[model samples]
Target chain A: SIIRILEERTEPKRDLEGKKVLVTAGPTQETIDPVRFFTNHSSGKMGYAVAEAAAKRGADVTLVSGPSQLTTPFGVKRIDVTSAQDMLDQVLIVYGEQDIVIKAAAVADYRPVQTFDSKVKKQDGNLSIEMERTTDILLTLGQRKQHQFLVGFAAETNDAVAYGKGKLERKHLDAICVNTVGKTGAGFQSDTNEVIYLNREGKEQHLPSDTKKQIAHRILDEIVEDMEADRK
Target chain B: SIIRILEERTEPKRDLEGKKVLVTAGPTQETIDPVRFFTNHSSGKMGYAVAEAAAKRGADVTLVSGPSQLTTPFGVKRIDVTSAQDMLDQVLIVYGEQDIVIKAAAVADYRPVQTFDSKVKKQDGNLSIEMERTTDILLTLGQRKQHQFLVGFAAETNDAVAYGKGKLERKHLDAICVNTVGKTGAGFQSDTNEVIYLNREGKEQHLPSDTKKQIAHRILDEIVEDMEADRK
Candidate 1:
């Protein structure tokens, strides 16, 4: 009974004790009007799992989330946002304080150039919405990096590894998790995921299909390992 | 204790016994690519409530719903659909046998002209998506109606009642429920709603702000009353 109690006590490793972590989750909405919008298929499971895992490991987690039905993880401070611009603002406000920043959110690349205050009435003809790019939040954080270990997520349909590797270098991220979407039991709304964890140092770890919770902890382990190696 | 037990046993009104009813709920999503989509702000709460209430009143209810997080109400058959076209197809499949049909879904007025099989790569400069109007499901139903008592919902930003009345006449609907969007405790994702009911004979009933469940029961009452009046 004593041995079982000890095993239970040590099962949770607080390796991230006193560390500050910021995780972003869900797909940011780009409003077309008061009632309609454009969005991706992100369900925020991966990012929420990461936030929960980080908090369990004694990290101070600040989760910047877009519109999702997920509840806030215990012991994590969550900032709720709607559009891509709103998410960027909140993330930037707390960017400097985070020791590690994981951009797991599938932020919108484009938004309608003109957003109406009232609901747009359907008319006789086809409606073409001219779109402009949202400010790249990850790129901004990468450009302004000082001591923070930055991480990014690449949800790809093709050339997954190559795209992720490119993002890691271009965004100056410490690592990027690449996951191919449009597959069964992987990516988007699925609870399970398979990802290629690629770092700036050209090291790649292939994580086979697993629940997002397990994948999140493994990703954290890699992050800690990479940070320690850099210190040496 | 005996009085409370007796009240519970006799409380439910089964006025819709053996009646066939079909209710459509939520916002239909029109896809642009593998990941991104266009959608409106219909939460399907109002529709789900209607289905639940109808089923409780002894109606054989079939709910054709778009993408929503809400659970299917007990004793109601639910068919989930994504795009506006999909919802239309599903609704029409069961339209023939229903005595009452309620079009509560916020079907997209427009969809991308071309839906890509793969994810669209982000490129330089602004991107413009050419859109086309989706098939008007209610109009089609109206044209094909036989003995069905059709009801439509109009979610408007301006002239809610006028738009609803126009839809009632144009769609040949027995009744139309109009609710203004972009308001507090009403429309879209709100659990509570206030709606104005208008019928073909120019009868109008304004239902003040109330829980969607209560509103649903009241709307059903109006539908039954109007149907009986027509019979007389």
Candidate 2:
């Protein structure tokens, strides 16, 4: 506990004071039935850190999270959601009022087309489950952006920055944070992250391997800098 | 903490002194790809309780667990596992030395036929996952059992008793514990359970809604009783 506290950014910036921020985190579960579901490897750690950092810096943070074991960060409002659709519904309800939005969640791209009422009993021979696309939360948020500073995260296995830039342009996001997954100690479920923050203005900042908490603070600093430049 | 401590069985029984007990707990995850997986709703609470109770009763316990957040009970040896196949391998390695074995983990009945090396990129159309049956750990154990008192757990939505009995007979288990899922306060992820413990000798015991810890003790008591009778 002491080491974790020490590892965290101790000096609060208060730079985001009075700002309304919303962040979505964790991996959404798509239920196949009462007993079974499909899920991904997002651990919600990075997003939780961001929410905590923002809250500590005096921003009113609302964390719309999927199923996660992490405790609620103090002073941050949290809304728990299960499926990707459920998350989108909640995020949309509060989207208009937020000054900043971060889509850090690894939402399921597909969900089972048919969810059974009861546990599907084991049948003879092989089984096949039909799945369809879930609504893209970030894309919807980007399309509807008015004054909100929207940011998206792209976790890729290869050509991370290129894919992230493509997502940034396609989703109409102000900025996108790109990170390589499948690397040891750098992605999903890890405390450390190696990220490249790229903005619409072609500004790129590479943050080397660091604690997620520290990285969150640095990312916020970049967002603040970009917002200030846009105002001028 | 005080409330939980007060609710647990306080008196320690040495009824299982020097006996070797092995328990399998939690929900096994079957990876569909690097990012996505299929899993059930088993929280491993019941199995962990059984392990804790067994250890407290002076038994040497080995807890072979799937992905669970619960901590290992005092004096219990824990072996973490992921998929159903991994669980089976770990269990079979130590099965012969165990005096009692409890199948409490909700091992996935099916697994994806193919797992991709990397994350499966989203396509324009819907996706269908082909799945095949996983080996039944309990059935395999029963077929190879020597002096071990084998027990199995059946969590079902309908005809729980009948299904559990059939499993007991078909698997050649010494006893089977059946509990109805989808109830408000019982079965998966719940601290309380309403169980029907049935043995091969046609003896039936109804354990009303109670904390998993207390129910575990009762089940052990029944096993001990039956075991003593056999000795006579």
Docking class of 2: medium
The true-versus-predicted C-alpha distance at residue A200 of model 2, in Å, is 0.8
Q: Interface Cα RMSD for all candidates?
A: 2.5, 2.5
Worst 10 residues of 1 chain A by lDDT: A182-191
Clash number for every model? 0, 0
- What candidate 2 gets wrong by more than 4 Å, as runs, is A1-11, A183-186, B1-11, B183-186
Give lDDT tens digits, candidate 2, residues A156-198.
8878899999999999999999988983313698999879999
Candidate 1: what is its chain A TM-score? 0.94
Chain A structural similarity (TM-score) per candidate?
Answer: 0.94, 0.95
Q: Give the TM-score of candidate 2.
A: 0.96
What TM-score does prediction 1 earn? Answer: 0.95
True contacts kept of each: 0.76, 0.72
